[model samples]
Target chain A: MSDVTALHPGDTGLSVATGRTEALTGIAAGLAWLLAAVAAAAFDDLGDWLETQNYAIGVGVFGLSFIVLGLTGRWFPRGAAWVTRAGPWLIALGLVLTLWQLAAAKLGWLPQPFFPPPQGILEVYTFEYEELASHFLASFRLLAVGFVIGTIAGFLVGVSIGWSHKAGYWVHPVLRFIGPLPATSLLPIVFFAFPSSWSASIFLIALAAGFPVAVLTWSGVANVNTAYYDVARTLGVKPLGLIFKVAIPAALPNVFIGLFMALGAAFSALMVAELVGVKAGIGFYIQWSQGWASYANVYAALILLALLCSGSITLLFRIRDRLLSWQKGLVKW
Target chain B: MVAVELRPEQPAASAGASLDIENVSHAFDLDGSVLRVLDSVSLNVEPGEFVALLGPSGCGKSTLLRLIAGLEPPRAGQLRENGQPITGPHPSRVVVFQDPTLFPWRTVWNNVALGPEAQGSLKQQRERVDATIDLVGLSQFAKAYPHQLSGGMAQRVALARALVNDPEILILDEPLGKLDSLTRLTMQSEIVSLWRSKGFTSILVTHDVEEALFLATRVVIFSERPARIKADFRVDLPYPRHRGDPRLAELRRESLALLGLAASW
Candidate 1:
């Protein structure tokens, strides 16, 4: 801890003090695990209690981890940073899980079939991993296809409408009328229009994703600074060159805004589409599990959905960062 | 130091085209009202000569440059390039706007390469593109994007972009207007050096009287509102004229008085 404190100047005492606090937090986390283990072993459960082996293993592993991290964290700066940052959150998570186990499983404060112990949800992952993986893959495939088609079609049409006066005149009013109609609200019509449930789902997702791209692309193209066009024109850029070179590049920041909106809308549409008629996806898994009162499976599937949505959004943001790096400080992330 | 060399073999004789603006007038339709910007503006810029149009703000000096660039058709009369009537924007004439107007998406090299690229001569003139960028002292920043540049650096890229085309006429619409005082002064000399080297017929529109007298071989002043060529003065000083030259000081005073400002110099 003293060596770590020497790494940064002007704050030696404060740094040493913070390092001590970090070690203390780690010990507290270990203690919380011990307390949970004691409760699990001694307390009488209001409901039928399963064997406490899983809880015992978890407590032991966590307790060992905290003890190791506390003693040796300052030796490695990278490890120290992680421990300092995540130590409190880990402690809070452990406390929350312990309390949940006591209330939901031991005391039966929350009714069964609706609320399950944390171990029960973990058990679903352990037992039904294959089925969950398949469902996730299916949903991912549908999202990829629909998202690609929608974004491409939307971009082309938006660029056309924005670039050409004739196209704008013909399409702008029609877009204005239909673009505002929510894609989910069109489900009844979509069902009648499409022959298969899969096609209907894809269509719904595509429509959901396309509107924002089109509208934002239109506005982006329309609002490009006239000075850019003037400069390009004097440089001998033809009409096609003007559209492709000046208008498109200038409008890219707004196009990314459209893509972000499309991602959100696509996710919402994906979930709803899967719930309505899709045979196998995470959303369908949730609905099917809910019908049989398998709350553990439902919670497990919900967790997977959360991870998948956030993971995909993160991927999109990474791509945006790479392409639009010039706009770094101008936009507030 | 790698000596920056512009392509000397690129037909220097036809590189500068004499501009003849004969009784030209232009107006803009501002919300169903005709705002007369230029009224019978007539001037001649000889090939390889540096001419400056000096005027007050909103006096349509820039509008006249745009006309010469063929960006807009005059409301009346004709603008000619080497005896040919100007009908539309051509590759032989390029305008550098006050805003730099560097496409934010492109790097310094790509922005400067846009002119040759548009002309479909990028394949043949690739070396010229590299040379022009080097000439502007931005070879190190070839791959740097426009947003990464300072105001002065971006404007240098803009100038490089115009020069790469090897335009017969280079029209500058107060291209250094947005720079800080120090950057502006530096750029003023850079522009003069570039003009001296290239020897393209140049027309600069500026509100700064000192800038006009410093850069232009001939200075034409415009009146407010319906801008007409009020007066034209020839600067016969030798190349590399001193800033504190008594002749320049005399002309600055007279030009300021003509523009309805008391000379502070």
Candidate 2:
């Protein structure tokens, strides 16, 4: 990394290509004009029908977005103005849509759901904060317990099978028969067999996520240079020392990648598991809210889940980076 | 850093070991047929002696060095280090691989310090690491990794790492064979200077006849495969002799001819 410090940014492979920037700008300007024309023409008579048509509304917004993109692409593709202009552009568009929703609903404008209005969603977030937080906590707790157990167990099993042929030989026969079977499908069986509690949720998460970590970890350990083994042998390192010092450090970079994959799978599994014979968690809240016809709250839960999933992944990435800072920029994803 | 400069070398008296090879033979299975790599090859090195084994590729020069270093056991014969059969790799015998083979994960100091910390007293080992770092002229690059060093620099670090242990015999597996010609000459000179200063028994396995003649007191030439000692020629030339120097060239021709590489000269 220190060796790379002297190379200039423009010369780097990282910098974006100039041609791509030029093309995008040209497209954005053309789009903005087309959108402006559609709105201008539709404003006269077919405005009500145009808003009522989801397809038309989608196309109009898309065309207008391209216009903005074209302007930026031509003059300010990735500059501060491009990002700064986006907020005002979106607010203005939202204001127009809201005004249209009020007028168009009377005139039978865009489909009923399309204009649920920002105020309704905001009411769900601010007024129902306490209710959403508990659901958030429930899902997070299940994920925390399950992901941690699954990741650690997977890493250990992976290292064991990867480091020794004996471990691989003895465990591989059973692994072949069992590992390929989907762990998620067994959640129903587990739900029926075990009491409906956090234990079952944790178990479900662990089962679903464990396999990838083990397999990826095994590959990482097995693929290191054989000369590393020879060097360790010459140095008279004992078996345990070799595994700990040589194999683990060499395999960790790969193992972290495996963990990242396993994490996403774990969260997905947790969501499905939370819905089974459960009355808590974000998934449960979405179902409960839909039953009550609180569509705004249901959408809010879905958004919250998306935000949580994104946050957990980002958090795990930070932890992985910290653990393996020796391998800087190693976690490219 | 303390730099203790030696007055001069008494090449025989201080060169590290007296190794006894008694009828060592090694064979491998090639397509269900047994192929011999070394055939009853035997040599002896007195303390502080420099021996260069010269041969072409597929020759058992490296195989013989590994045998002496206890990298692999001989099938037929015994290798005696101080009147005992050589077993597995020992700290007393360190190998400098052609690629340097320094551990990339460790800094220059830690890599060299590995052997001493493995076998010697802790306080003594740490001091030895610093001394060897200075000896190899890598004191400034102590914090650097092997990948950060050039080919010549890495090989020097390998040499320093092997030397840090204060090994009895230094076995070089063509350690400088990959360097450019100018660097090779400079390295060869540096190696000789180090050997003279440290007084370690050094065995260099190389195909270069001129290098063998310039560096070794006794140059042992080997056959192509099933390599056995074809001839052992003593240079009788003084230290730091150039390849073009008449006396060294005369010996180089003799060693080359011994291996059937040169026409009548």
Model 1: lDDT of residue A287: 95
Q: How well does each candidate superpose onto the true structure, as a TM-score?
A: 0.91, 0.77
DockQ of each: 0.76, 0.28
Instruction: Name the weakest run of 10 consecutive residues (lDDT summed) in model 1 chain B.
Output: B1-10
Q: Name the candidate that leads on DockQ.
A: 1
Model 2 Cα lDDT, one tens digit per residue, B113-195: 76655553546567768878888788999998777889888888888878776667888888888998998999899889888
Give fnat for candidate 1: 0.81
Given candidate 1, what's the lDDT at residue A70? Answer: 71
TM accuracy, model 1 = 0.91
lDDT string, candidate 2, A1-333, tens digits? 545746664545433454354445435443443443344345433222322344334545655665465445545556423533453564455446445544434344545443343344555776789989998998988888898898888888889899878999987677667676776778767876777657777887886677788888988899877656555556555567668767887788788788788888887788787676467999889887777777767778888999898898888788877766545446455
Against the unseen true structure, what C-alpha lDDT does each candidate score? 0.85, 0.74
Q: Kindly report which residue stretches of model 1 are placed more than 4 angstroms away from their true locations once superposed.
A: A1-9, A14-22, A30-52, A55-59, A330-333, B1-14, B123-127, B262-265
